[model samples]
Target: MTKEAGRGHALLVGAGILCSRLFGLVRQRVFSHYFGLSDAADIFSAALRVPNFLQNLFGEGVLSASFIPVYARLLAQHKQEEADRLAGAIAAALALIIAVIVALGVLATPYLLWAIAPGYTGEKRELTILIVRILFPGTGILVWSAWCLGILNSHHKFFLSYVAPVVWNLSMILTMLFFRHRDADRLIVYLAWGTVLGCLLQFLVQLGPVLKLVPGMRLKLDLHSLHVRQVGGSFLGVAIGRGVVQISAFIDQAIATLLGSGAIAGMTTASSINLLPVSLFGMAISASELPTLSRMAGDEWSADVATKLSARLNHGLERIAFFIVPSSMAFFALGNVVVAALYQSGAFTRKDSYYVWAILAGSGVGLLASTFGRLYASTYYAMRDTRTPLRFAIVRLVFTVALGLASALLLPRALDIPLQWGAVGLTASAGVAGWIEFHLLRRKLNKRIGATGVSVAMMVKLWSAAGLAVLVACMVEHYLPLYGPIVTAIFVLSTYGMVYFGVTYLMRIKVCVEVLGKMMRRIGIGG
Candidate 1:
């Protein structure tokens, strides 16, 4: 693809992702307003956890990481037959695996609920079991959707792929609104079914273009293909890594369950809020860059691949820093107002906002680190070096376990802090783990591709902009009542953005220049 095409693709994806994230924030507001850190919300969030965890482990996390690179390589080499065969084989295997897992989840709902949230013994546990069963089949739908998306991405049909999540979010919002008045607890079950429905739609939407690109695309079971084996190994590694990450969350939820009825819900809501920026900017860039990196790798253009990958990485980091840093600072400075504006209606109370904001602030510290880690980890995958990331992921998992244990056994007494801060420890652990992973990936890339593959100067400028934005945001927060939380949020965001852009441009940051140049060309204002 030409640079123009790449920039267009990234813009389309970035814009779509921002829309999806906006809808997601609205969904969270709905949840917060109706549930308000209650037992019902806690049970619902906990129940959704297992299915969502499995979806990530088997569907998005493993399948996309494993399938995209190999599929891209096969398409590049004109091995369409092999790519189709491999896709069919993997899809068939995933079908069987998802089926068995769903069955097991249904049968073991009692035991699974017990192991994950042992503190819930009465109605909460029963409701959780029912909700988990309702959501379990969503894993199957999502797995199929991931396979379809992998095919579409490999074919460089990215627009619809980016739009699919918006569809999913919109459907869930509609479902929640439809059922909000009738037993809000039961609405979660409806949301789960909506998830399945959304996945089906997402999969079918991408199928037309994929079939056009790979004329021989078929749904068949062929387990003996050699290419399937290669994809399978990468898939297994990714599954392990993703499973470890999920385990960390599981541990936190279990610990929170023991603390209080609303603890799990509070932490989950805060986490969902924190993940918004990460998904919009970090994951969007990683997804957009993967195909390009795979094509570069397939062509044996290591120098060009390294340069392009580093440029994209630096750009992603700067963009994320530009937005996330100020957002984080604003959340910390105006935690209550932000929460009140978004989620203070219905059952949500001032107390609940305070607790949730505390969790959000803790999560914000880790958010940037984790986002950067995702960008760096993709570099390793683009180089076809999954083993190194796997090793780093294992070490990160160890840190999670150690930190979880510390939080469970020693943290409460040693710090004299309340139990609600349990998630705080988990977030800190993840932040530390992300920092380690970034440094390791950076060192490895430097060794393999030389020092130029890392962009130190651009990062310095990004950090400078972030620091200035924070200072400006703090001043705005102090001086402005703005009369409303939404208005204040807008003021803070717009002010930070203007200052950040103006300063970065004055400093002549190359990435800013490139982004502005692209914008100018798009507007037919400059060549």
Candidate 2:
């Protein structure tokens, strides 16, 4: 794809994701208003993790890595008949698997709480089990929705797949609003039922577009087909990689449970805020580039092919870093403002906002590395090298587990700090692990595809400008008598954004200049 085409597609993906994420934030804000850091909040958080495991395992990342490349390449070769068969086979097989998994998950909910939320007891544990069972079928439906995403993305239909989640978020939001007067335990059960309904709606919305794209689609098991086998092979590796990552997340939650009452809920809330940039920029660029990269793959690794791939990868890295740099800085310096703005009403207190801010700040440590690692992983997927990423992911998980234990369990007590601070340690340690994984992925890919990454000088410029923006925003917050979270965030964060764009424009960063110029022209201010 041309650079302009690639940027345009990435922007489309970003717009869709932004809409979904904004609604998701609204959902979380409503959730906080109802439950805050109470026991009910912790139960919901823990229960949701169980079903999310199913979705993450069989969902977007897994499908993108394993399904998209092979399927997209068939389309690039104009083999629509074969592509349809491949899609049909995978869809049939995925449905069968999801049905079995959901049934077993519901039956095993009591058992799962032992591993996932070992700290809970009596009523809390029983309620968690109930919620997990209620959510299992819904999460299975979401896994099916991911299959739709793979089909849509391979056909280069980006927006609807990403935006479909808005319905899912809206369902939960409205459920909470309708039952806002109810107690937490009963209201949460209603929310789970709402999630299930939303899951169906999310899939139905995508099914229409998918059917249009693949009119010849038919459902059948075709394990005998070579392309089907290829997808299966890649699927296993990606699944294992995704499983390792999930285990790491679960371990974090398990550790959080040991920390204290509010720890799990606090971490979950912080993670919601932390994931914004990752979903918006990291996932967007990678998702947009995957098909183009897959289509560009040559039969042989010739110099021309390597150079083309490296050029695309480097440009993607640059785009991610430009946005993520400022996001990381803002999280580190002004996270409390962000947390307050998004989720500090009703039961969520000023104290809870600060607690989440600490975790968000810790998350900023490896934001750039983690985002860059995602693009690098996508490049590997495009090259049909799924195992390399799986290996690196396992390594990252080990570091995460080891470092996480030390930082979260031991460090706080050693420092004579409150145990609640252990949650921040968990995020910071995970950030360190993310950097390690990123280094390995980049180093290995560079050897295979030649040198590819954002330039050091480019990073220096981004960081410098972002640092200045944060400094100015902080100074403004300090000097001005900001009254409320919404007003303060609007004024201060807007100032930070303006300063970052102004500095980058003055520095003649190509992307920044182009974006600013476009904005100016739209407003009738520039040539």
Top candidate (TM-score): 2
Pull out the clashing pairs in model 2: none
lDDT of each: 0.74, 0.92
Worst 10 residues of 1 by lDDT: 450-459
Give candidate 1's whole-model lDDT: 0.74
282 Cα displacement, candidate 2 (Å): 0.1
* Candidate 1 vs. true structure, TM-score: 0.91
Give residue 495's lDDT in candidate 2 (0 to 100): 99
Expressed as tens digits, the lDDT of each residue in 141-171 for candidate 2 is 9988899999998888999999999999999
Model 2 per-residue lDDT at 284 = 98
- The total of clashing pairs for model 1 equals 0
Worst 10 residues of 2 by lDDT: 294-303
